[model samples]
Target chain A: MDGDTRETIREVAIDLFSTRGFDQTSLREIAERVGLTKASLYYHYPSKQALLTAIVSPLLDGWRAVTDEAEGMAHTPDNVRHVLTTLLDVMVVNRPLASVLLRDPAGVVAAAGPLWQDMIDVATRLTNWVAGPEPTVAQRLRAIAAMEVLRAAYSSITYLREEVADAEMREVLLDSALGALRR
Target chain B: MDGDTRETIREVAIDLFSTRGFDQTSLREIAERVGLTKASLYYHYPSKQALLTAIVSPLLDGWRAVTDEAEGMAHTPDNVRHVLTTLLDVMVVNRPLASVLLRDPAGVVAAAGPLWQDMIDVATRLTNWVAGPEPTVAQRLRAIAAMEVLRAAYSSITYLREEVADAEMREVLLDSALGALRR
Candidate 1:
């Protein structure tokens, strides 16, 4: 019962936080949405910050898993493709959470410092792999552009509401990303 | 004196508003930055909204110019190259204001409404041009990816602080945008 209530709180909080700015949302709102009292919500999550942490914790774990896997592989094109394909999978699955996180202030997330650091570190690592060492301006921009495009494409799915299925969109995004990288 | 003061206010407002979110900035801060009294700031622009309007009006005009030029031409590859090249120039020149405008909520600028309408109309026209009469999902996503990359690249100039000259970067961006469009 305790765990179930906590899950309910987490779902409602994410919904409300997406529609309303994180700062504007209150525990009271989450409580109302979850049919729990503020005191109960407090018992489950001490603060909105804590609730956000709990929601993103899974995403962090997934990200760590991908990076850890990448660490074992050689930096070949095949490895690069695998890294991006796996990243695309993670992003597509977490589309709702990604949209919210993208819109929210970096400062807000940075307060949970280690998670923020990991994010920057991962982004830098991916760009490095794409650009290799001593990259020129064009090489750096191309890498950033391709990665950003993939993220945008995944995020677009929620709003685009296209008839195209996820699998096809996945292929389109991956192919486009690879093209952008090679171009 | 009036025009000069207005220019000063507009510039300062963009800087402060970019550093602080639109909702977070005060008219007093703009006045202080411009070295004006609140009364004088109000005299030039009725509200912070009006200040934003003044700052972006020129950008809107410039955008309108690019789009207007694009409208008269055929949506061929050569035409697309010309259009993006012109837009890249406009974006790089108005880079600071463009960065702030992109970051701020559409509603903040939408109050006056015509500018907002123009914004939507122009984006639609550009996307339509890129996507053709009936675009496939891949085509649409690729077009969006290219445009976003160009914007990100331009916005990055300030942060990148790279020794690369603007003209060379322009060519690089142009080549990249064209490549993305083709892909």
Candidate 2:
């Protein structure tokens, strides 16, 4: 249960989950790959779901942090730009984590109430950022539109991997998303 | 293999594909749901992959049409807005079809050679549109960003479903996506 062992387990779990899918991957396979006995692995994370949850906690934290920051920002194009830039940076930096969030099992989201709540919280913050303070109905609609676009672009890494550098892509994506928010 | 029956079969296949996934659903299930015998289904579509390709054809055509229109227009914000607005309208009107295009199996993009080619052709046209008649690096980046945001917003029906009506949603999404191309 040292930091290194925990990190190792999380990384292996991400790979297996992404490749084989969340339901198909097993805790035993993850433990064997990490060179840990079942008892030793269980000491760190008691269940498979717990291990999966741990792997995605950082993404949840990052999403929450961005949304929280946007909540306090003044409603202006500049502020909207800053929020979107930050959000895209986090997504690009945590591409694998973001992928997991996008591909979360429908069953898991249904069963895990908190996970769905967190998603709503993050989405609300994103929409609010685009709408700004005291937004018109049109602005709110625009915000929803912007959020959808950003989600699609960021979720598809295969598209990203082929076209441009990650940093450049991030800048472009944020620029487009924020532009959509502006009047 | 009348047009109406062919269209009906495609519609049923899209619903089933989205819900049960491609592999899990079979030709028999589709035929049963559509009230067509397997022989009749085969007359219209030789195989499951053929059925999928037929469903995706309209989406690819729409992409091409938009890209062509954008290419011919002046690269002003107004023109950009017009092109995207038109694209979104078509996309929204054909939501079920667009969803199938977006949700195709990843491996099929390679194995289904014609489908993949059509996608590339459409993407190339889009990139060219953003690049404008003679695009600067920043303009090219803006184009890429605009395309990414537009595609993302159009594909995501689950998140913003409540906020905007289907028709209005298309307008809102297009406006925001075009916002990136504006100065």
Best prediction by lDDT: 1
DockQ of 1: 0.36
Candidate 2 lDDT over residue span A1-183, tens digit each = 456888898898788766544544567788799998777888878777687678777777888988888888777767777877787777777777656544434324433458767877677767766676776666776676566546545444543334567766676567666677666
DockQ of each: 0.36, 0.26
lDDT of 1 by residue, B1-183 (tens): 456887787778888656554545678888887887888998888877777778777777888888888888888888888888998888878877776654443324434457767776676667667665578888887777667667755445533556667787688777777766675
TM-score of each: 0.83, 0.71
lDDT of 1 by residue, A7-65 (tens): 87777777765555454566787788788788888887877678878777777777777
| Per-residue accuracy of model 2 over B43-136 as CA lDDT, tens digit each | 9888878887777778788888888888778877677667777776676667766555444343234335678687876776776676578765
iRMS per model, in Å, is 3.0, 4.3
RMSD of each: 3.5, 5.2
Candidate 1 interface RMSD (Å) = 3.0
Best by TM-score: 1
